[model samples]
Target: MLSTRRLRPSKNKPKLPDGVRIYAMTDIHGCAHLLKQMLRVIDADLARSRPRYAIEVYMGDYVDRGPDSRSTLDILIDRSRRGNTIFLKGNHEVFLGNVLRDPSLLTDWLRVGGLYTLMSYGLAPSPTPGDEERQHLVQAFARAMPRQHLEFLRKLRLTFTCGDFFFVHAGVRPGVPLAEQQETDLLWIREEFLKSRQNFGKYIVHGHTPVRSPELLENRANIDTGAYATGNLTLMTMQGSSMLAV
Candidate 1:
């Protein structure tokens, strides 16, 4: 059965009362149907003022796994153009960056849901073009992506802090100021973040590790939840220190 469970607000992240309601979602992979439904839920929530969180975000892995990555990106890009959207770079986005920088890595990337991107772009079963054609295909694909999406992907913050919350696609390195956190940590670190005893100062919310449900805790929350094949996208909302999931 399709779930429509109601989530209560969290005490750590606050909701916006005067402006947008501030909704954050993670790891869509490529499930377009759930993306559509989530968008509807956000809109409907805002329209009815039901716990009211308006700003919507997708915390990476927007493509791959599912068959509708292209359409999924289309919806995100369109909604983003209208304003009040935040798209973070998940490990999958990192894969895109890597492939564009060096197509030779396509084989490795394809093993982790990247095959969908090549197929979406109408490419071959084998990795990608060889020495002579790499530049052409890479440049074309780069140019084809929406400028804003590229900019968003490129400029994504390693760590984002608002109120008492800190967010990264993965987790940050231990014992480092939020400003000094490394890119490798933001895009990859997992075990260190999970094992650290000292508080990283703020509640870190991340989405690198996949889970069946939103992993909410005092230190960090893993919201990846593998939505691509399951057709379920998990989102955690913060309203004035109260946490809620939709």
Candidate 2:
């Protein structure tokens, strides 16, 4: 694990274009209903403001620990088709892809909320799946997953930047230059990123570590709000330096 203490501020920072309003959401887990409600709120807020342009950035963790992973992905896929949106990859997604490729990893996946994800696809969740059973589950998932959802997961971005804000699935590694941070850290870092107050050049907005409420820090903002467990999904509205949860 990387050290979190005595971190320094970043030098390379990028800003979002002028007059652009962005709605950044993170860590839906498998709460499709919450996601739908949040989107409606965002749409209404955007319409009231009427910015020159708007973009929706989803910071990933679309599945696991919740009842509707399949429906959540379906909603996100449909939303992507309607307008501008950016989908990011979370640790859960990485695990999902890995299990799809190597069934042996299913045991580890199941321990960390993958069972719910499997159930969402209408597949049986087993502690010890035989070779034949593993193959059947894989095939079932393949058949259940829509083409667009597969593409969405396959092409999910690791990081996104807009007007002085950097977005990632998880927090960035402290002390490492933003451009040089590793994918492993970006997707899975916890204490190091959470404990450090070092300026990451841009305000990093991320989700992975769930919190009871949104955490606003000098370097980053954690908006996960544990939607899968808490039923409170956070949707943040950002315009220049002004930001608020709707």
Model 2 C-alpha lDDT per residue in residues 1-246, reported as the tens digit of each score = 111122122433334678998888988889999888988887887779999989999998999998899999999988998778999999999999998898777778888888898898888857877778877887788788878778889999999988788999988988888999999999999999899977878789998998877777667788888888877888887776666774
TM-score, predicted candidate 2 vs. hidden true structure: 0.90
On residues 1-246, what C-alpha lDDT tens digit does candidate 1 reach at each position?
345434442443433344335677777777778888888877776777664335565666777777767677778878887676766777778888888898667667778877676666665454654655655666666766667657656765455566666767888788998888877788888888877755677777788788787776556777777777566687676666556676
lDDT of each: 0.70, 0.84
Candidate 2 regions off by >4 Å?
Answer: 1-16
Clashes of each: 16, 4
Q: Scored by Cα lDDT, where does model 2 land? A: 0.84
RMSD of 2: 5.9
Candidate 1 error regions (>4 Å): 1-20, 50-54, 127-152
- As a whole number from 0 to 100, the lDDT of residue 227 in candidate 2 is 82
